[model samples]
Target: MEPRKLLSSLFYFSLLSLLSANQQVVDSAHHHHHHRHRHLFDFRPSKLFVFGDSYADTGNIGRSLAGSWKQPYGITFPGKPAGRFSDGRVLTDYLVEIGTALLLIAAKFVGIKSPIPYKFRRVGGKHLRNGMNFAYGGTGVFQSTSPLPNMTTQIGFFQQLIKEGVYNSLELQQSSVALLVLSGNDYSAYISKNGSSQGFPSFITQVVNQLVLNLKMIQELGLKKIAVTTLQPLGCLPFSTAASSFQQCNGTQNALVNLHNLLLQQAVAKLNNETTNDHSTFVILDLNTAFMTVFTNKGDHLGSTRFENPLKPCCVGISNGDVCGSVDESGTKKYTVCENPEAAFFWDTVHPTQAGWRSVYSALQANLQQL
Candidate 1:
């Protein structure tokens, strides 16, 4: 075959795989309220149940106070903040792939509608019955960061839905994939509360322990596959690297982050081994490596994405008294925005642009297939 034809064929095959998977999800969701059913699914999940903090937050945070809600955040896609913490889509949006043929077929066979009507307009309400997200921004595995429910409490909400019969076990078994993201809000809170570096190791262990427990709980609640994230290079976040003028990542902080990721991998391994069904029940999405790849390939990656300076954020405060979302006492805007948000990777100080998330999503495409 010609090179162009070969590439087109590969793309079509991938599209077919996604459509078949989404169809199964629609079929399973249909029978949940009527009768229990089971079907083996080996396709990428169409529905994404996002958890964790800002990295995966999709408008769960309030607009008035969150930096994601301010100007220049969504300048790339929506032309304004549409509840994402970044200038465009976050990890959740890019991690998801919705093919039109699948949605149309689902609408025909299942008589279901898409929950996000504007985005997936043709699909009816029945399609949305596959999954619903419950993540909130600024939250941690523990109860210290955001006023919203922590990881435990978030699980509690899922439990409540189960009790109300919103999700039957069969539907959970067939169509569900949980995206659990714990990107270190707990550690940030610990440091802000005066926790010392000497205690960091122990705290890291505690966080991992809690995270493992959370993943187990999600599994116990009947989710088929749980995709937990290895924490990103925390020291590399623009917020932490700013002290060095965003030119270098803090090696010490990255070392600590590696320890946390090591523990998480171990926990995932144990979970996979312990599963009675002998399936690849637990998978760790390697966000750390993906972030590093993007950083190291900055020149090549940025040029491809049309980003001039990927590390620097598009919207930022001019001084210490301001932040991306802050306003002056006189009610004037205190932040500055780059001429083109899509040309930058970092959105504010810590978050990535939609383009950045797309890059990370591409890196994790293989891992996401398990779900």
Candidate 2:
């Protein structure tokens, strides 16, 4: 070979060797990073146990009884009603969404997912480890309009499952986090039953007292972390504001709700105090403040396209006597839906739309960090 050609060949060989060495170092560093990423966060909970009402219920209600199973409930999600009270996913779904998103930061932080409804656990298969949801629409800590299990009865079901060896104490102690949502169904039932305003304060006290007992019982069951939600702004619900054409909230009703929340906060604090060794096992998720934040500053919280009227619902009955999802004997539709469900805040008279829940969840970031 010519001298120049030989020199050129040597130069190219050295360059190729250097490039190969650099590639090997990059691969090794990437492997180290991926391995570290998997083990960096040790905060993931293995199971999520859900309790309370329509806000957290996945599909615990019977198709014939719960309006959630009727049309327009799950339209934004599974493309049809799937027994969720809202037009799509509810508060629990958004919780799972946040948890799932955490996986991008740390692979081992598998994050909490919405538990399977207790009624569907027989067919849950591999999903049983995700925990169980005992929530039923229209039910509360005490009895309400719905015939489904009350909070006490719901806990009974959990105890029954435990006795049946479905979940061992060690398993619960090691990996469970319970979420309790009591969103004012009891108050609704009280008013409907003609319980006078004079008795409202005492009734709220009873409700919170029972709720505190329920929270303590859950802790004694071996689950270490429990999150109980405060009542949302009741007067802001479409049902209360409908009298004002969704223009103004009923101050009297909201005052009652505030009283409930205040009592709840104190109860949670007392529970936490009793468990000093555990250090804040009972966390208060302030849905009340979060809802108000979104309602009061819809444009600021949602950005760009806000709810046209934050108090106005996206679905309603055609007449005064009807309700959302209502149909006549001839199967004629008796309700109307808005042009854009995503642009609305409330889904029906009581529940928030999917977008509404999403915005509320974003506002709850500061509080959820405690979880």
Query: How many times do residue backbones clash in model 2?
Result: 0
Instruction: Please list the Cα RMSD from the true structure of every candidate, rounded to 1 decimal place.
Output: 12.3, 20.5
| Local distance difference test, each candidate | 0.59, 0.69
True lDDT of residue 246, candidate 2: 93
Q: Judged by TM-score, which candidate is best?
A: 2
Candidate 1 runs further than 4 Å off: 1-46, 98-127, 299-303, 306-308, 366-371
TM-score of 1: 0.78
What does the lDDT read for residue 258 in candidate 1? 70
lDDT, model 2, position 105: 23
Per-candidate TM-scores read 0.78, 0.84
Candidate 1 lDDT (Cα, 0 to 1): 0.59
- Taking the tens digit of each residue's C-alpha lDDT, what string does model 2 give over 217-249? 798888876777777777777877889999997
